[model samples]
Target: MSKERSSRILHGFISACLVAAVAAFIILAIPDHLGRAGIGAGSATKKNFPSAKNLSSIVDLEKEKQAAEVKIENPSGQLAYFKPEQVPIPPGQDAQAQDLTLTDPNQSPDVAGGSGAAVDDSSFGNAVPIEPEPTETFQGVPDNFVPVAEDTPRGSSITLVTYPRSSLAIHEPPAHVLRRSKKEYSWIFTPPELEKDVAFWKAIYSRYDKNQVVLHHPIYLDIIYDVVDLGYIEGDMRLSELEKQHKKEKLIEEKRERIVSILEMLAQNQRLSSSLNDEEWRIKKLFDNVGDPKKFQRAAEEFGVRAQIGQRDKFIAGLKYSGRYLGEIERIYEESGMPRELSRLIFVESMFNLKAKSSVGASGIWQFMPQTGKLYLRMNKIVDERNDPIAATHASIKLLRHNYNELGTWPLAINAYNAGRGRLKQAVQTLGTKDIAKIVKNFKHRAYGFASRNFFPEYLAALEVAENPEKYFGPISYDDPLRFEMVRTAYHISLPSVAGVSGIPLEELLELNPGFSSKVISGDQLIPIAYPIKVPEGKGSIFIAAAARAPKSQRGSIRHVVAPNETVNSIAWMYGIDPTRIRQANANIRRNPSKGEIIVIPFD
Candidate 1:
């Protein structure tokens, strides 16, 4: 063969071998590729069957997505759901998306995309932004934001939100806000005429302490003669309480006499004198508003220096104590259609002193005398409702309501609470005006004294002080409001038995049921049937159960039939009980029990 032909053959043969090797390589690579594909398929199946931990995480994510759903009530009253993230939050509130609810009942299901579905659209309409309101204090929704509504799309539902009236901010208009309409408390308007009197009392409550005595005119409370410091008398540990009081009175009397003498001298002079001392000049300056010279004599005789004990400390303490019942008191007043502010009168009457009693028999925080108390409260040997803060509060509301109905003005009515309604009516008729300022300034009667004249002013002062206690007393940790559950007694039960069964402390029971007399507390008298008793909060059911399980011997009063020779003392001696208790138990019991007559023996 030729050399070229041999080379061509070798090349052809090598090419053939190379082609065979390429074919073999292709055939071997196909299986490896198939094995890799099978491994990838196995990996895909493993992914489909996730680990338990991963499955749990997926479930949690789904739950979070569901929680973020906002429920919107449609016009048909069916609930529609949409993700909260779909709605834009108001600018300043930093409100949580979940907290936002599309509350507009007129909303259509399509607004939420569909019932129980997420929203699809990013843009609904131009959202009307709500202007934030300024608030002093509130607890519910942020006062800043009102409900925002979007303009409805022609073919689509608009996102609308409407807040309930109670959820709306109670915005107190700024001083610049136009006072065009009367408010609910329009009747409680402070007359410009009595502003000075109100200011004077406000000062007494917030500015001065008990050891200070303010000497001012009876009519014009703004008039300042002097403020005598009785701190020395009070702080004298060497003196007894009676001696300190006597010394303080003597000092006050001396100061009044000196003031009266100065007034008399000023009246006699009838003109300003350069020879007047610094003290005299100061006194003269307070009367600059009084143009007449003869008025000085009237000031001496009619408007003599009246000393007022400062009550700043007492007022602060009262503000703290008032928290205990102020909520309930306000609720009662509001329910009875009376201004809640009227409850602040207790600050003036007794400084929220539950056991306060006057020399003339006025009692309780309301200062209700026995005569007036009897009209609304139960006052007897067994129970004196006057001592109960809640009962007295109710009684006071009734009395105040009656006074308002009769007197026709809140000021006059409130004054009538201190002074008699008859006297206030007489003043209104005599003065021929319903204006409290006119009555307070001009009315003159034997019964209408300085306290009666200033009662309304004091009330206004107390109301202002109480409402803004932080402004006057700074940050105070007020006592928590009284929390209790009321349960009525099924039987005539003794307090010990109730305490024993209910598992409540005896002292707590006594404190809660203050209407119970000493006799009742001591087991000499029994709480009447169906009498409501206050127990600790969440203990009403427990108390009821305990009361039901009370033994018969511990439940009610014991009774005895009078024999032929059974005298009251003899019967009492036989039962080992007090005759007074027997008399108290039986209202119509005579000195000697008649034969065959039943007598209720007071027992625990």
Candidate 2:
């Protein structure tokens, strides 16, 4: 056959097959579809209504009854598809009634003129009432449950507002770690971030052991408590009668026994001694009785054998101040999705000291380094937001959330806060695990040191001690939180001038706004435009009005020659300003302004 004839034959064959397939589909589907609509083959329709004349003879009552029974048998059928005129909609029902909306509005006497098969309106009520089932209860998908990256549009830019140069003139110093601590904690601050290969879990675990209470030198001091001896064993320090009252726990029982034994020895020694003073006799007898006094003293000096009484006393004092700001701290941590107990980290960091600063440049209660502090806080010559408890808490919250997001666990995230997230990430990826205990035990890196490994454990210890301060120490009195209102500055005004206008003491105003750098207060730099100066509550209006009435000359920057007894803090306090700003103004003065030094004080 020719090629053209072959193609035509193939096309005809394909067309015939298509027609057969379509005809077969219609044959199979027609019955099911028509049956659902109440119109199917072999299903004869019954007359539902009687004719006006000879109603009984016009309708077949038996046939209608059979049709109704069929509908009842197939409850799933679409009875709604039937027209009221074509099928009997039991009497007293509307022609447009839905399958579910059935009602009997009238009681007709069994269609009096119709045949005995007349539909009864009340019969429809026997059918079960169908209520639309509640849409499958929708529990929304969680944020992390799905792949968000696939759904989020790429390359979206978000705007962030920092301090406005136009509204507030700010002079930020070069970013560097500013250490302002009184004591150096050689152990706590020397550790590096956790490493995958470092195995320091044993050391880290020691801090978390509830039964083992370890004491070390504080970052703020270099002293250790004196050692004492009991009948059975020696203790680092003697506990007072009040201290004994709180030492009832089983874990503390052993330590308490040792302490009680030492007290008994001290009492016996005191009774026997005739030459020495009470203090001298106690010391001499303790040294004479408990091994060698010189040996114990040297050991304490070298190893921080016991927690210093002065330091602990200072901590107890710090708790008093913590009461003032704990609420705000908890609120910040909670809002940031961090555990509220983490606020106790501040106690470990700075003993809740707002003015605390480390030699390495970490500052404030959160101990943020200058570089990190600048990320969330305004760290400048005129203002360091880290000094503001509320501001620093906010910054700390943001940093902690970022840490948690990156590390996926609180311990690792908290450790990242001290050691840096990049190192933790590298350690986690290298080790293929984020378990803090495992990482601490096995992780090894050049940068991972004692401090980084111990950070989380130290936080846990701090949290434990802080939660039960009354247990560790005696009853404590908390400082009330500082309350103040922020008042905006229209122009550069002197800190002293602010005090004068607000009718508040210069010391009080300066205490209220520790965030202001001394330069802004001392007339070296103007209190930047629109800078909010905090004043005692209810003093905002009076201060603003007073500031306006104050002479322009008083509000401008001034040159002051430091005099005798004029330290930076004292000078700053004199002017209602930040001492840091003053130190910034005079680069030569590293910490305090020396006597006879020339310093410029900025008016705000």
Candidate 1 lDDT tens digits, 386-406? 788777887788788889888
- Model 2, CA-based lDDT: 0.49
Residue 126's lDDT in candidate 1: 13
Task: Please state the error at residue 592 of candidate 1 in Å.
Answer: 19
Cα deviation of 52, candidate 1, in Å: 57
TM-score of 1: 0.61
Alpha-carbon local distance difference test for all models: 0.64, 0.49
- The digit string of per-residue lDDT tens for model 2 on 1-604 reads 6999999999999999999999998987776677666577554432233222222223333443333222211222112111112222333345664232212111111111111221111001001112212331112322222111122111111111111121001112211112323232122221243321122222222222222343322221112123222212223247654554355233344543444443445545544567655644544444443354344334334323332122354466667777666765565455455556567678768887888999998888888887777456554445676787767777777787899887877777788988899989988998999877667657888698657766776665565456555556656666655455444543445566546433567777878777777765564444533344666654444454444433331233455655554455544533444566666666677444455556775442
Which residue window of length 10 is worst by lDDT in model 2? 120-129
For model 2, the superposed segments whose C-alpha errors exceed 4 Å read: 1-310, 501-503, 553-604
